[model samples]
Target: MIVAIKYPNGQPYHDSTHQPLSKKAADSKPVQHGHRGMSLEQELNRANEFYLQRGIANIHKKPTPIQIVHVDYPKRAAAKITEAYFQQASTTDYNGIYQGHYLDFDAKETNSPTAFPLNNLHQHQVTHLLDTKRLGGISFLIIRFTKYQETYCVPIDAINQFWERRKTERQSIPYQAIVQHGVLIQPSLYPSLPYLEAVDHII
Candidate 1:
């Protein structure tokens, strides 16, 4: 069974081996839930903005292209988009430059405790990330375990390996594998997810 561990005062609640510590022995407060209601997209947007303000990195979310089919305009009012459909998005969610390296990644959140379902990712996304990696760009997936309020930055190479193993393996990547191979990130007040720090270790 999965037991949620709360980290108060931004301290690491887990041991070096990532085993959750006993709550009774640790003097800590409860996990704050103020930002829990926000969606992952909103969190990334805020984090990107934080990065930009600090002049540390310049990253932005890719806007989804919409094919507007119909629009109604009133003489004294603004036009309203009536009908529209999404154009196929080619690349990952966010891409930009950081420390002279091209960065590309997709953000995902899962509620599952045992494993992360492969179905959450698309074949096109995998191909895009692989191509980016081949081109010498840093590519990865930012996965958040929403249930545990834990987040990790997993390299594209690791993802590619599991992605290829799907042919003969299970449809999901086990959580233990992720913890072993992925970089765990502590959420911060600014640059919220602070994923780039994990990237620092990777590169």
Candidate 2:
């Protein structure tokens, strides 16, 4: 989604002119509900860093390419970037090489007791993963059942099936189905999530 200069808080601005958040959907930040007590992003970043360091996998978070509209050039040596906006994300959250295979996937956490909401994914992302899978790439979604404290590695094809027929099926993958078909990823230290272990077992 293209956005103008906006802070992490979702506050808006037009060239540093603060606009009133009158009717904006400014919801409070959601708490991280996982074993390691870290946000999903933080844990994945730490895992990626650890994997890169040990030369295990080169997975990395895809940065949201942004267009800088304005900058405060207080000094020539170091320009203070004051205003910038993010363009729409075209692919999944994380992508890289792992054990001679291409990896493309996204991570999501749900507090619901039974089913994981399919709306966590976008149409473009589903299409991207399907395309990658067609080329023999490893694609999946790392979903955390926060309240249950269990993580499941659901294959991209399964997600694709649901997404493509979502209009007709209109169904969410329940916890029971996840356990039946999903690969369980046990938690660990250092990398915190140790999802690679599960991937290894599956592949």
- Candidate number of the best lDDT: 1
**Where in model 1 is the C-alpha error above 4 Å?**
1-34
Query: By TM-score, who's the top model here?
Result: 1
Task: Report how far residue 53 has shifted in candidate 1, in Å.
Answer: 1.0
lDDT of each: 0.79, 0.76
Q: What alpha-carbon RMSD in Å does predicted model 1 have with respect to the real structure?
A: 12.2
Report model 2's TM-score to 2 decimal places.
0.78
C-alpha RMSD values across all candidates: 12.2, 11.0
lDDT of candidate 1 at residue 62, scale 0 to 100: 91
What tens digits encode model 2's per-residue C-alpha lDDT throughout 73-144? Answer: 653334556789889888898999999999888999899889887887788888888898899988888888
Span of ten consecutive residues with least summed lDDT in model 1:
17-26
Candidates in order, TM-scores: namely 0.80, 0.78
